[model samples]
Target: MIDQANKLREMIRKKAETEKKTKHQIKVYSIVSGKGGVGKTNFSVNLAIKFQQMGKRVLILDADIGMSNANILMGIETPRTLLDLLKDDLILKDIIAKGPYKVDLISGGADLFYLEKLDDKKQHEILSNLAELDEYDILIIDNGAGISKQSLTFTILADEIILVTTPEPTALTDAYRVLKAVSTYELKNKIKVVINQVPDMDTGDYAYNKLFKTSEQFLKIDLEKLGYIFSDIRVNKAIMEQLPITIINPNALASTNISQIAEAILGDKEYNYNVSNLKQFKNKLIRLFG
Candidate 1:
């Protein structure tokens, strides 16, 4: 698998060298759930670490509205948040918090003013600054669960959405509900599923098939599989310690699954999420939230 990955990466490199210098593709993925307590943020944080390991400049935008905590999960301290940008006119570069593995983090900071009263001029200022900081290769939005307006907005605008759920009955039911909600947004192909906390590959396959078959039969949408994370004690331990499990215990079952998932995503390059500039990407988000 390592050799295959190396050859694939080499092919990508040669292809890139021969092609003209177009803008770097910045992929945005919204990791969401039907309800809370399903390990969505944990997956996002570890996934960021995996992407960083793969040599991609990864950023975690804890845009989960009232429940944002990518910094907390990574044991990071950012002196600033989105509020700093709105209130004190802080640049996007200034408010960004650095997390483990040097993954850049941006707090949602969705205070009343940020949620409802941020003026267009200030929005443009922050976005323009963000456009200048486009060194990142991927931005993952750890969005809040369910059909909240903010969550839906983030998922809809993202280049792709990864809907997470466990194998429990209630969780699977809610996962389906979230998928139904995302269907309203009409980015069917961009939606993927991640079955978390499975006991084994059989359980994972069953969970994924349950949802996949349901979505196909009822919603008529073909959801792709991003892969699954097994139930691992190291996951809970790392969460309590506020560290990425992959960093703390790479040999853990969940970490191994996440690593493979990240590699699979990197190897699939059929989609290009190029933002002409960072300001342009900001405009897309602003349109969703403004």
Candidate 2:
């Protein structure tokens, strides 16, 4: 028994050493919309691909609950999903799929009814697994619309919250609602806006300025403008092909705009797009899973 105890202590020490050597590379960014059909999923997919292009290891989590569309946008068929991870006792590596630009994708399938009933044990396990995903340079959580508890929780926990909206009044109202809800957590510093599907820069600026003023005056939220993507038909074509616009048509206006937005995001010291430590985490994961 004494020998066994000594072995266990050595094992614990080795594990601690591995974790200490494992650099932190994961940055969770939750992309949410005020309304549906605002191209939120498209933006999320392209942003993930852009990060991958910049040589960062990225994992895109489709956190949209019952109506996940990341798989559709990426044009890949996911055999397993977040449901399998939560329900079937499956490992993280088994459920993650590879997409365009080498982006890792995980689908949030229709089995999200259990989210509300999650017990402390399940919540703890989920968060533990999430923290262990140090292999990813960034984890993008594409959340569902209309201020659900899951969406709010994701936004609150994320290192950054990207609110996407169009020039439509309804979309703007919904964006404000989400901003206000997130402000309740005092996370205004982490919030940023992306005006999608706008006709031009002037219109996008108008929409962003309106939200910025309202958030400052009413919600006391200091929102930053990340940039905008134009309303381009090529986005729809790329979605139909199950490819990111950056891969399908990199020279398209929307694609160029998306890349610029990505650059702006990386410019922020808080976002941390550097990939020097991703290789270390990947090596650790390979060892642990092998």
Candidate 3:
């Protein structure tokens, strides 16, 4: 009887381990830029699609506050947004909209601005609601251009941050500034760079090397080159039609680059799953602001 009980317990333990391994742990990635018009929203929307294509459940959180427009790129509209959740006390599931590739979306609209003035009770309520969403494998938060208190909060709380910038000198300067601002938080999240709208491979290489070396030398932090998007006309064409470039033209250079970026990002999946990512992010947000 003792030996039989031991064998049964071993089987139960193995089953539990397998279940844990297969369970999805949500990873929050904040996609930000130093200035506007660097294709940050476009990257966020399409990158979420790429992750979804890899068989992971992905959600795009358009946390751009007053400039929330990721839905425009996804070709969907959310009648109910994060604002409705805060104001109407609606559950998160009700506010979520299905976008391209069937990825989930939560449009923050202008209502996200209220995050600054959230009372303790409201903060807890919001965090609690967010914690309830464990079905997603990834959450890509498309933050507004330029740094603000609200945007900074989201950036600091993410599991990783992708700083998008162009090859222009001004864009590089702004990207460096974004890195500087993030460094103030003594952040642990991995910071990656995506050189968007580059005219050629040389331009992309120059941009990445500039940003990478600058961050490493001055900020004392290393930045990863996630990948770069070519200056492809298909990107704009897809934007006009309200479709992700990946779906509109998977063969497009921009689409292919994004796929490579997704693969690079997922290359480190051998690590143990972090099941408490959302909870930890929530706690930090509340503790710091609540």
Estimated TM-score for each candidate: 0.86, 0.84, 0.86
Across residues 163-269, which tens digit of lDDT does each residue of candidate 3 receive?
99999999999988888888867664358889999999998899889888888777856687888899999899999999899999999999999999999888767
- Please say which candidate is ahead in lDDT: 2 or 3: 3
Enumerate clash totals for all models, in the order shown: 2, 1, 0
Better of 1 and 2 by lDDT: 2
Candidate 2 lDDT over 172-260, as tens digits, reads: 99999999888887654547889999998899989999998888788867788999899999988888777889999999999999999
**CA lDDT, every model vs. true structure:** 0.78, 0.79, 0.82
Q: Which stretches of candidate 1 lie over 4 Å from their true place?
A: 1-22, 87-89, 112-116, 271-280
Order of models, best TM-score first: 3, 1, 2
For model 2, the superposed segments whose C-alpha errors exceed 4 Å read 1-13, 21-23, 86-89, 112-126, 185-187, 273-290
- Model 3 misplaced stretches (Cα beyond 4 Å): 1-24, 86-89, 269-275
Cα RMSDs, all models: 9.4, 5.9, 5.3
Residue pairs with clashing backbones, model 2: 75-242
lDDT of 1 by residue, 1-290 (tens): 99999999999998875342234557888888988888999999999999998899988888777667778889988667766766664676778887758798987756512644667786666655654545788889888877787777776567778888999989999999888877766755446788899888888899899999888877856688989888998889898998889999999989999999898888777545333344456667567656
Selected candidate, larger TM-score, 1 vs 2:
1
**Pairwise TM-score winner, candidates 2 and 3:** 3
